[model samples]
Target: MTISLRSRHRWFSALQQLAQSIPYPLRGLLLGLLLWSTLTSAWINPDPVWQAFAPESAIAALGKLLFNGTLWPHIGASLQRVAVGLLAAIAVGVPVGLLFGLVPMIERSASGALQFIRMISPLSWMPIAVMAFGIGDLPVYFLLAIAAVWPILLSTSSGTAAVNHKLLLLARSLCATRSETIRRIVIPAIVPQILVGVRLAIGTIWIVLVPAEMLGVSSGLGYFILDTRDRIAYNELTAVLLAIGIIGCALDWSLQFLQKYWQPSR
Candidate 1:
């Protein structure tokens, strides 16, 4: 009994030291580890959901999928849609955002309509998208663009409105033309906000891409998920879901690195 108490005390002390070593935000990871340990004991049966997450089964599924050469194309297709949709959103959103920001009258005139459209969920337009664009990348692109544009537009407009009035006055006093003022001062001032908006838009676009891809597209992670379900490949389905989560996290982290590296404050 004394030896067992000593072992428990040492274990708790180690855990306490670990908790103190890491940041508060990552402490949840310790909880997740505890939950995983408990689940491992309870997951002895080959229940599809439990077995799907078993590390050995997950690894096997990943290996089989990779060896079959069936995975890369879906990932590539989804990435292509994301790239196209993000670019389109940025192209149209930035100019409109700038216009809305610089001109209060225009923003005021369009605010109600913008808000109304913004409130409409992108998924709700799936049927109309298919009917209009007719069952292809076009429909998926339309949904992604609609989902991503609002954040960029709103952020750009807010950033533009928040530009320092005194700086603008200084530019005007120096006889700077409107175009020069915008090019030099306005664009530079709002770049941080633009990056933030892009980050937000990227996250939104990635999320919408999955379900949007399910709209009759032949190839994508979403389609693969459906395929796995139809074929009853639950382990592979779980592997794909895990892959999506990991890839999505990687993309978000890459964007965060860009934002931090390019941001003025360092």
Candidate 2:
């Protein structure tokens, strides 16, 4: 009995050491395996709701959709909308954010109004957006832009406010002109913050893009989702959901790469 106890202790110690030695990526893979196993079991269970598409069937449908050339165009269309909307948001939000940061009075006066508007759901404007801009990409663009702008604006404003006061004072002491101080010191200081904001905006815009695309746009992942639903293609719908998760993860990783590249030391 003592020998058996010693043997069990040794085994547990070895297992613990093995777990600790495993790299992070391997750990993540193990977790993924566990999650996949659970999902597979759930899919196999006798549930009518889940019977719509099992994990294996969803994988097969995704492969079929990919090979049949039914997926790429919608992905491209969604990406295009995201690009255009994000650009517009950056263009408008950055300058406004700068102004808010630089001028205390403007920030104070605008704070309440901006917060009120910001609190309103972007989707709630759907009817007004459709009425004002009409059907198609215009309304979708409006929604995406609105969804993205707040993050950029807030981040830029906060970054600007957080700039080193000593540097500003030094510029003044050196008799630097307002424009020169801002051009050299302020802009550079705020750039990292702006990039952070843009990263956040991209995430918000991507999430909003799908639902916006469903609103009369002929080509986009959202439209594809609706199409699959109407056609009773549950597997295709699941495939699209998987595609969205994969693509979203990729975009987030790309943004993280850019953020690290921009602020390497920070």
Candidate 3:
């Protein structure tokens, strides 16, 4: 039993060392490749239908898309929409959240209506958005913004409410103006929480952006996805799906890095 335990410990330690030796990005890439290989191995078959989904074909399609420069515009369009939507959400949500946190009476009165609206999925607003804004980027922007706003609003409010009372008292005692107090004391203290909300909002916006692009937009990754499907280009579709995953992962990692950088020292 002692020998078995020792051997197990040695094996775990070896794996730990091996994992540690790889750079962080390389480790993620290696793990992704491993998973991809496993999925290909399990799903590939001799059937003609399955041939469309072969990993080799998808990889070739990805390479072709990159080499031919057909993918850049779509990527750019999607990124633009995400940026616009996220900015809008932040602009509206942050101020509203601050108001709610500072004035409890107002928050209490509006909570019911806010909760009701929030409970509705942003996707469900697609028809209304289209009707109101027409078939263009406007509707897509609206949907993405709606989807992203809830997280930012809630996170900012929570962070504001959790602010140190003593710090606020000290600022008051120092005769700090309201704007100065907010700028110096509240904003910096709540930055980490705001970043967390932004991270969550990015994830939500990305997810909604894909489907929202289907709303008569001529360009975007979402449109590309539909185009591939309409053309029956399964390999290209797979490649686009892979691209989406990679892009989303990259965005999330960036936000994670930002959050860590802004996190308050213990």
Candidate 4:
């Protein structure tokens, strides 16, 4: 029985290693192929009604969109919005998070209200955002910022609270000013946590971006999707959906790489 268990474990470990060794791009391609195969098999006897959804049509549409530079403007607009929203979140969340971490009284006082606000979905405020900001990119920015800020604030506060007491004590012993200590020790100590917050914020922002863009925005991936649907271009719509997933994945992978790269050397 012991030998059998050992052999099973060994086999599992080998399989895991083999899977890990496969390149990410190759894995993505394999997944795409599997999806393509499934779709092809499912639609073997496709009716006219389902012709727009054919895999070949989608592939052709994707190729045309890529080759003709038709998709670049929408991609750029979405990226710009994401960048602005992320920056706003960092600016607001980091300072407030630091305050919460450093002052227990303030945190206690505001915790309930903060949690209440955080629990509210960003999308729920869409009508208010549109009414207050009056369309264009402003309302979209507001929504994305709202969606992103909570994760950043929470992560930053947690990181700050978990900072080493020994380090703080050392700074005190050295008669370091509060600003000096924070600048030299606290910020550096919490960098990994900040990156974590940024990563979370990015994910939240990306998710919110699509729906937010639907709110009277003239340009963006979301707008493109609506346009395609209105035009009865299902193939183009599918291609855009694929693009969104690919871009989001790339953004996440980039952040993960940055987080790993920025970790303090042990």
Deviating ranges (above 4 Å) for candidate 1: 1-11, 22-30, 33-50, 53-56
* Backbone clashes in model 1: 0
How many pairs of residues collide in each model?
0, 0, 0, 0
- The TM-score values for the models, in the order shown, are 0.87, 0.85, 0.87, 0.87
- Per-residue accuracy of model 1 over 1-266 as CA lDDT, tens digit each: 99999999999999999879998746775676556545644455545567566656666897788789888899899999998998999998999999999999999999999999999999999999999999889999999999999999999999999999998999999999999999889988898888889889989998898899999999999999999989988879877876787788888888788777784432
Stretches of candidate 3 exceeding 4 Å from the true structure: 1-44, 263-266
Q: Clash pairs of candidate 1?
A: none
Residue lDDT tens for model 4, 183-241: 88888888899999999989889888998999999999999999999998888998888
Residue 9 accuracy (lDDT) in model 1: 100
| Candidate 2 lDDT, 1-266, residue by residue in tens | 99999999999999999999999977997797567646656645666556456667677888888899999999899999999999999998999998999997999999999999999988888999999999999999999999999999999899888889999999999999989988888888888888888889988888888889988989999999999999998889988987887888888889888777785233
Native-referenced Cα lDDT, model 3: 0.91
State the lDDT at 198 in candidate 1: 88
The collision pairs in model 3 are none
Supply the TM-score for candidate 1.
0.87
